[model samples]
Target: MTLDPLAALAGLGFGLSLIVAIGAQNAFVLRQGLLRRHVLAVVVVCAASDAVLILLGIAGAGVVFAAIPWLTTAVRIAGAAFLLGYAVLAARRAVRPRALEAGDPQASPGLAATVLACLALTWLNPHVYLDTVVLLGSVANTHGDSRWLFGAGAAVGSVLWFTALGYGARLLQPVFARPAAWRILDAVIAVVMAGIAVSLLLGL
Candidate 1:
């Protein structure tokens, strides 16, 4: 299992491409980042989850996943339900938008609750398995003995993305301070969550 720079670089690019989408997980991270509450915990949970999934894929768990289609179906249904619930919450927030108040203790959830939400967003999403475990695994294994190196690179990409999304979101604080801005953001989140949930259900 020799370390290969080319394989690692390819894995990095592939990993970034897959995760750079506007998904439920990204949305949650961005929101937490903007709120500046439990950002580090959320980032850690998301990045660590991605790393584990990528490594699992490289370790040939993708084969097991593929062999058991029913498992993914069950996950998909559960994810869709979770997404729908989040969508409703987002829609409710959109209906009653509030400006960002950094000093407001009630504005953000507690750390434990935040961590739980982050875990749910990361793990309950069935697409995560397809992207990280199945697809990334297939691609990394093609690197032969350098597959572990590729997995490492992909894991790094995940960490980088979540860190950026979670910490860098503070940069948008000025804009999001406006209640209208939050209204728009929540509206968008509602749509994205509902759309993804519907797609998941349809696929199942």
Candidate 2:
């Protein structure tokens, strides 16, 4: 289908607004980057998953997502709990420093596992559904004949953002390899996750 510039721009703007936020998914990506884990796999998985969701949104399937009130609430609760647990784990990691020796890349996470993890992180979050599929799609649908253009723009935005997040964080790997830096980063992640959990609980 032919793409419309105005619709594409609108979708691009919407995608940026929602995806640029620092949240659980971003934290996960940053963690993977810090550990120097399956970087390419993680980026591909996240970007591809976002493309699919944006397409689904453009296809008018957003209503289905909106209809699942209970499911969304359940996901939100689960996400909050997971974040809190992760925060505790991060706090522990911060307190106990691990050896800085790099492990064999081959022994780390595989492509399939990385993809699955990213998919679960993206799909299991109620916020993703509401922001990308429901709210963003609703706005794009108002474009009438240019709806698919909006989806394409959103898909592109996802690719750009995920690549930047997954790869860009790697720039700090050299610094983070130091035991002290690792502790600080871990502590920051813990605080961010805990704050997010509280925010979710307060419905903020």
Candidate 3:
């Protein structure tokens, strides 16, 4: 089947719209980018994971998920719990904010730990599956024969977003250099995380 450029662009726009929100995943990526700690690994993991999930969604995983309603319920419960826990941690960070320094030995986590954390942040959240696999996939399928092209576009959007977020954050280094900035950032992240968790619990 021939690829449709317009369908691809539509997919790209839709994908970006979904991912450009402020959430735990984006918050973590921004923090890592600011700290310049395992930025490449984090970006790669997030982007690659999103690509896989989006493709799965396009391939009709959404139908599979729908068939097993109990699975989504279980995932929602676990995801809500995890988000709330992370929210508390973010709140703690806000209470004791730290500056983002380039070479702070104490501030930097090991590469393996950072990558694992990134993966957890990406995969453990049920919203990721809903957005990428279900919503995006459903959207792509609407394009008929161009669905794969649409999926490819969405994957490209994920890659572009992660790359920009992971690298573009450095431009804000001067702003994040202060402890107060970190405090504000963490506070925002905490609120966002908590809000999402609450929404999940309420089935929103």
Highest TM-score scorer: 1
Report the lDDT tens digits of candidate 2 across residue range 133-162: 777778888888898888888888888887
Looking at model 2, residue 2 earns an lDDT score of 58
Question: lDDT order of candidates, best first?
Answer: 1, 3, 2
- RMSD of model 2 against the true structure: 3.0
Q: Is candidate 2 or 3 superior in TM-score?
A: 3
Model 1 lDDT per residue over 117-197, tens place: 889888889899999999999999999999988988898999999999999999999998787887788889899999999
Task: State residue 93's C-alpha deviation in candidate 1, in Å.
Answer: 1.1
| Superposed model 1: Cα runs more than 4 Å off | 98-103
lDDT of each: 0.88, 0.75, 0.86
Better of 1 and 2 by lDDT: 1
Q: Cα miss at 26, model 1 (Å)?
A: 0.3
Instruction: Assess candidate 3 and give its lDDT.
Output: 0.86
Expressed as tens digits, the lDDT of each residue in 62-155 for candidate 3 is: 9988899888888888878888987898787778534334455655579998887788778878889889999999999989999988988888
| C-alpha lDDT (0 to 100) for residue 130 of candidate 1 | 91
